[model samples]
Target: MSNEAMQVRALRGRVVTPDHIIDDGAVVLSGSHIAWVGTADQAARAGFGDAVEQAQTAPEGGYLLPGLVDVHCHGGGGESFPNAETAEQAMVSVLEHRRFGTTSLVASCVTAAPDVLRARTRVLAGLCEDGELAGIHFEGPFVSVERCGAQDPTYIIDPDAALTRELIELGGGHVVTMTIAPEKPGITGDDGVNAALIEGGALPSFGHT
Candidate 1:
């Protein structure tokens, strides 16, 4: 094996996996990727003696798990994604979540004017391009006022397929989903919001009642 591949590090903790938890486990890292995972004793037996020797031990009772993915996040750290006008402003929220193990996030926007949506999309798309965001999610502008929840009722309107397409294009292919109301007109049919979202490589998240 190459010297680069031999450079490894390990961490000891209670590792959480999909099937079960390892009470006394070690995760070996080779470069940026996880090279191996098993019990602490197994790490040395599996030809990772050097890694185990240099392993960082987690606090007692601490659990090591995979980073989280938040699909519908507005903001954090006293910053709001919907109102963030600059990339730096938006990054404040991203970093806040990342500090707490949310490595992937989709910035969500509430009901707003078409112009506001356009502007926010532009800013968020830039973050997506830079790999700081996973995708974008629109929570309104085509939802029920009675069930709007936190959505701005003044900006709630009938679904517009054209507008959906426009926002998707603005997202530069990082538009993951848009919240919509099933009862709203232009939500179904061939040329409606649902069709437009699917065609644009996005999904319709039925919400707001």
Candidate 2:
């Protein structure tokens, strides 16, 4: 015989789902995911009176929102990802972002030497593997020097597919995204660098150009 299905629980608050917001509504949570979302009255009408058992309610004037994701944050709390002296320092930065309500974050590194970039990527990759970070974001070297805002223009270089692969490989498949100027040196139409990023399951974003 089949076992009893797990009971659904409700969280009463301002439920903000992907599509819409439900004020004074309830969110049904099944295990780790959102199972259902609607007004409390609607749930009761749908035969979920018992489902509201042991549910939580939000404080007055409070809202429940999905965890925020930041893709291009460089540093916070007196720590810089590109200048991270150690993994511990890097973690401090992550904590800072989290405190500001960033549930998911990618550690972005600025323009630097290949060796420096590789080292930083490896450190950030470890954080990703540990589930503390989303992934690493390389935001320089392949960007335009003229458009380089805070990045060190001296460290900027043309896009090199092999070098890109080196960084990606060093990250052990944790490179989530990299900003590239399609007009940067070594990046022609159908540049191999873009191909390498795509092949390694990393997104090639356009910026700084």
Candidate 3:
């Protein structure tokens, strides 16, 4: 058997799965993956009674759910991803969110000057390449100013294809997604900014109006 299948660890709690919830459920972890899941009693009766590597149980009234994915998190731990000057500072938010059960996150950047956005994307891209962050998200210079809740309206403008391509190239294949306002002026057709994003393998997600 593979090493992963040979080693077993278990967690018991109020397990929450996609299909249903087990009030007193158990999950068996084999190496890094979940090997089995069911009620606590079922686990005890189903071959897991043998010597296992480790076991954990939740506190009374605690629940066990899958790690969360935050798609648009700007910051945590008093550090802002868009405002971070260095990778270490940016990682502060990454680690902080992970500590709270967010296992997957995208570092989102807000509207900023072209140079500022490029510099920050470089930092976040490095993090993505190093596996510290899932990817980078540009929340825009391509969005509508009237609906840009927290973004700097001063930096907001019509989508520019050249700038779009530049940011993606700088990200080095780690530009997983970006936000844009489809209704924003000059953002449609062949020369549009959204098309540039697609050609660069980044998802042109419509958001922030």
TM-score of every candidate relative to the true structure: 0.92, 0.83, 0.88
Q: Encode model 3's per-residue lDDT on 2-107: one tens digit a residue.
A: 8966678888889999999999788888777788888877765677754222458789998889989988889999999899989999999999999889988989
lDDT string for model 2 (113-193, tens) is 998998898888888899988888898788988899988999998789999989999998989888899876666445577
- Encode model 1's per-residue lDDT on 71-100: one tens digit a residue: 999999999999999999999999999989
Q: Using alpha carbons, what is the TM-score of model 1?
A: 0.92
lDDT of each: 0.93, 0.84, 0.87
By lDDT, the best candidate is: 1
Task: Tell me the deviation in Å of residue 147 in model 3.
Answer: 3.1
| TM match of model 2 to true structure | 0.83
* Model 1, position 126: C-alpha lDDT score: 97
Cα deviation of 160 in candidate 1 (Å)? 1.2
Highest TM-score scorer: 1
Shift in Å, residue 180, candidate 3: 1.9
Clashing pairs in 3: none
